[model samples]
Target chain A: MTNATQLPVTLGLRLLRGPAGAVLVMATIFVVATLAFFAINGREAVSLFQEMVMGAFGDSYSFSETLVKTAPILLTALAVALPARLGLISVGGEGQLYLGALFGTGAVLAAVDQPGWILMPLMLAGAMAGGALWGVIPGLLKTRLGVNETISTLLLNYVGILLVSFVVHGPWKNPNSLGWPATIEFPAGAIMPQFFDTRVHMGLVFGIVAAIILHILVTRSRWGLGLQVSRSNPRVGATAGISYERNVLIVMAVGGLLAGLAGIAEASVIQNRLQDGLASGYGMTGFLVAWLAGQHFLRIIPLSVLMGGLLASADSLQLYAQLPKASADILQALLFIIVLAVASLWGRRRDI
Target chain B: MEYFATELLTLLFAALRSATPVLAVVLGEAMTQRSGVINLGVEGQMLLGAMTGFAVASVTGDPWLGVMAACFAGIALSMVHAILVLGCGANQIASGVAVLILGGGLSAYYGTPFVGDKIDTLGNLNHTFVSDIPLLGQFLGPITPTVLITLLAIPAISIFLFRTRTGLRWRSTGESQDITRNLGHNPVHYQLAAIAFGGLMSGFAGAALAVDYTANWVEGMTAGRGLVAVGLVIVARWNPWYALPAALLFGASEALNLKLQSWGVNISPYLLATLPYMIPLSVLMLSYRGLRASGGGMPAGLSVVFQSAR
Candidate 1:
């Protein structure tokens, strides 16, 4: 066949391959699981699903809310995707995000009298440092002590939250705010500026820029090539003079940096304070987004926005369908399970 | 000194009671890991079990039934894990996270109605014959049935692992799947069974927490106890016999934290609450070389399952 004629035929065959087939099956499974859950709850599945769709995409306000939510999700997803490239599993994004927010809040509180130009950069730097420190602990342990990064990161997540709780409940407790365990609010100057009269802030710009930068780094950089080699075969990579341990540390630091940026964005642009519920499963959701995008840095943007829309609709699920707030969690969980199953099946088929 | 002795005795009893649930979960994970699969879905499974146990106990007014429901719920969740990891050759770590999300979501979604609802909990066992025995009675007087079962499970699991033919088969499956397959034993089947059994124990642990330990239902009630149990398994070196002491140690830390808080210690309660998590991290780091030397008792076939597919 001619090159032009062969292209369409090959593309068609690829879609019929195992991975694509698995995706189709997973989509069906997600729909069925959603219906089953709604049925069990005694709600009409079709109507609730429709309401979810409308709630997420119905109006300009909802779209803006999704975009707002997407910024942090995108950043956190990058936190996961980067380390995953180096075959490291770092699920401590929740912890890293919290530490980032804590440090960001601390910087702003300390520099309340400073101008936005000076204070904002300091806050960002502090947040990134805090997250990097948290992330590096697991990386160091994994490389130096042979500690399992997965378990260590998971443990640190709880510890990080507890550390934050200790501060907010003790040293950082705002005397003016009645009884709620929270730090002082950021100075108005420290708050990030909104974009185009929408609630979406400068964080959205940061997320897009970061994603673009990471895409370039992953696709066009020597470090990225080294990372891939280490991930594929550590012994071979070592023979080829790639420093596997260094890659682990570097990837983890980069991952933490992204997650830290997410924390600063959420604290300054969204909540405007360091408080409990700051992480709120965003770290876990970011894992889902990264997995769904096959850990592709560029794909994280669209996938995060998609997940963000689903999360935004959760409020409407409570309002319109009378479902609990956890209804959204149920949907996300089902989608994640299906996607993982499909991906696994695809991997198996490729072996043949 | 006498007063201090009495306080220490009371703390020991509390630690024993608190350690029951962790004991169950760690033992279950030990069994799962022994069969060459790492199931990190324990936290999620425990949550689902806790919610289901509470709901069933309240609705049916039967604590035993609640325990059974929790077990089935755990098994159901673990089945998903098994299908993904064993059947489809999914990455065990990733599949585990997905299962955790599913379990957390399902429990939270369905648990809304049961929130704030109360039921007759499984209270302390009333063994009149044993309670009449002087000083020993004083020490064991407040023991609950679930705690007794957990204590019994330690020996039972140890015996099963070391003295049974099926146990050898399970161990071999984890050690070398190729050999097991050559011997006409399906390694995947053993892994599924182990995973299911693990789920059952996790369910019982959740039921114990809900119907025995706390006697209440709330969303995400298990907290991170399931994950803590996983760490405990590592500390115990995957031996159920060692798991008992490790679990008690964890329980002691928790009890000590509470005691300190009650005594109005100057430290932040949140910081003290972090002791359980921090201890495990420190233990892992300090014992890394020793653990590596011992191979952490991980099944040889277990680590390669994910890699081979990739």
Candidate 2:
């Protein structure tokens, strides 16, 4: 985005150029809109606003939960950002995460009697494969059959969610639980390793490392150049031997694999079981975070954390404010719209 | 044999009842697509409409008023899309997704109070009328008018698209904004009108679900039917005439699932639930060549959605 929002004449806007300006514009709009929305409804708008902030980062426990939420968002964001480098709009992170959990849990169930040393790797591998499978289907469909990736991914999400629902309610229901619709608890060996005695797991490391590695690869490597070229001009990239179709599958697979890790992490470290609602819309949040960061991998790290806090806080808001948790989606949408509008306005200025 | 015969008789009417919302949404989405603007927010618009329809109908006790309110809500929501995509020259896909998020969030937030609430006028299924045929007259009587309007809409929309001047203008704008501009007509105005019309139909569809039959307000009630409409528009190859059969395909799967569950069938409901979603995917895959060969199924504007048009 251009530095047009921060002009001396536009200094009336109170934000300087770059990321800070964008954030300022988005935050101001979101805050005012949210406050006005609640105030118009005759609620204690100011206190509710404070409750939202405190709910997000107020104390140690809240902060940890925020980090736990951050892990999945971070991983899923990477899953989306990677394919976006090749100009693929993938909204399948939710489905991929579910598939990852599905496959990862399958491994756990298959080798329920195995020890951790052997079981851990198997579960992770299975999860990755499952996520990759979900990603690859859409990628393959797009490259081979010319299906719209957005619609394909969205449809796959429903199928993936129901697939989990079908298994848990039918074949995989824990026999001892009687009527409860969920699988057996994961054995300790299969659980993702936690950090600092908190719910933050190995998935966090995977996400951070993946983001850095992707940043290096995308910005510093010839393969990354191929992605950029292929995104901007597939014909040109093909002439340069980039093989756009091959790259599409690779990026999509790797993206799905990362999201799969997040799925297994959620099942193992947080929920401790393969169950329905395993994703809880983190995949959607991840997709939003990826887009919010302009599909830049490194930037996705902080954005995911910030978005995680928003989601984490929303949970708290539901507890205290008597509001539904989906309220956070409104703020997220507002941020996206505001950022998009400002960025476009900046781009328009640059054109002149 | 008796049970099977009884199920078969009502299944057609049930499928038509269920298909109404999807068919309406498909027609609207097709109108938007035909005008060269892809409104992925149809799903969100439907949800907002469903919520508003339920909320207003329950409070006002007037289903028509609720439906009108729902339509306005949808139009207002789509205006957000128009502003972002047209005024800001933003990426249409991102803008559409943003609108979806906004609609979903707002509906969820505001519709919280209306959960599990039902309006008396909407529960048409509870007050059944007995008939000599058992299923034919009884099943088709109350919903026949609704069914007629929905079915009639197919030809009505088709005539608008293929036989009217404005319809030609909308299709031409979808094909080429530049050529439309050269022809001294503003593509923006045409696309905006098409989007608003799509939103109106989406709202009407949602209201049909809320006040016309179910009357029970549930959170996120449309449940991806709007997305199915997106695929149906493509599967129908952007032709409103084909939308009915395509919508019925989805509606039949859903109706069959409900039937099977009621009959205590051994099949997992979740597995059956996957059928409707699978139709568009399979159709999209199998009919790829047909879609492209028949003068390109996707609008030229939609093909370049990621890029800034301005």
Candidate 3:
């Protein structure tokens, strides 16, 4: 983390002098290699980049789709980002997402014929409540019980997935469909309304609004300051008589609420029904997104959107390049790693 | 009742089969954590190892070679983490996550052709005479090769960690770096060796998944078992020997879920499937609570880098 000029300068050896320089070098290498790969394969790297931009925000139609994708990542990123501020690594967002989605879908299904006003609020509540409940488990364990949040949260993810899969396969199975593992499709009224003629639903707007509120909560509020103190030096905060236990629970609950709302966004806005695919790696990617952004709540919006584009472009890589969707997945992961490595190095030098 | 009994027995066998990968990884994690390094990249290492093992075995048609390849790949990937944590003094969590990302991508890149392709398995090695005794036989009924190997590994690791002087040194390294340094033994060396051992064990776990459990490699085939192994390590109090029973318990839950599915049960399959996954989380939570303060089981100064002056 030494300053760039602290060490003797040699053109070839510059990257080794400081952490930031090394990260810059790594990022340069990654971008260069990726473009070179497309080039060697006889594809236009520029065109691909252009397509990605178009796919992410080119037309009104695709722009809305990007919004649909960004909602979950935005909220889930908050789920990780908030806890990260408490020095607690809550990797259980995936599990919380599964639980939230399941509960949200279950609520909608129960009130399937209810009016849009009643059903919408109920669904959002269910999603948030479910996610919050799931979040509290790890929080309590870490704060009160002294459990390592990393392992606890991770294990919960598997549980959440298995639980969701079970429900989709068994009781929630669409009775009319032969053996397709999915919930019954939502009635038209139950689906969230699109904001304009575009595909972006109201959930994208909800995500943006949520981000603003979260920014205030993290940066300006008393609880936000308390969170900063806890993360930076929990012992100091504890000595100051700030209840670490209570703060941990509150922060996690807030994280859970955001993540759960993300699940609702998926159900009502994107998929319009709960399916087995409802909890697709959004939670995990949200972690990467948040981590890459250094877990700034406000920063998550752009990062999520950018990541949303990367995900949106993945479908095209499959269609046009005849590459498995997993290849694009690899690229997304590689970009995340590059960002994390760089951010960590940069973070060491910058005081948060 | 008869059907239920048979189903339970069948699941017992399946549980034994399914538990191998988890057993191997948890055992490896137990060793690493004992010396105060928590390698969160266990999943990444296992995936790389499994993919490597599968690709190598498929190419060479030698199960032994595949096993060796898996071990080598696992050790190689773990060393990358060692360099970051032990050499550069990076955060263990961050380093582990980085290695995981790398392992996952590497596996996906190399595992393209082998995805869904079945391979020649090591096959079952059920000792008929030993397995024929009434109730005792039922316990040994579904002894796959991996299961047998894992069972043997438990006690052997226990003896190695407790009975040997090297084991004591390894324990001291994990317990306190200062004590080990005071004793004139390099803690980083012990940490590296422990991590290397972990890589081999987790690799074997990955290999078992490809060759025995599924007989085919899938993208991210090791799934979250590596994380569960880490959970199991903490839940078991870093006891290598205890990992077997813990893994079996997890395997049994999975076996139950599979059996119920096979029987066309009407219950939510997700809830049933959740049985195994919940165990580790619950265990981590409970253990974390029981241990209270005292930094739980993590090694002191685990994330710090060491530079010996020449």
Candidate 2's TM-score on the B chain: 0.90
Error of 2 at A196 (Å): 1.5
DockQ ranking of the models: 1, 2, 3
lDDT string for model 3 (A53-121, tens) is 676688776766777778788888889988777777777778888788888888888998898899888
- Model 1, A138-216: lDDT tens digits are 9898888777788888888888888888888889889988999888888888888898788798877877898899889
For candidate 2, write residues A101-209 as lDDT tens digits: 9999999999989999999999999999999999999989888877778889989989999999999998999998778899999998998888788887899999999
Candidate 2 vs 3: which has more lDDT: 2
Model 1 pairs whose backbones collide = none
Cand. 3 Cα-lDDT:
0.76
Model 1: per-residue Cα lDDT at residue A194: 93
DockQ-based class of model 2: medium
DockQ of 3: 0.39
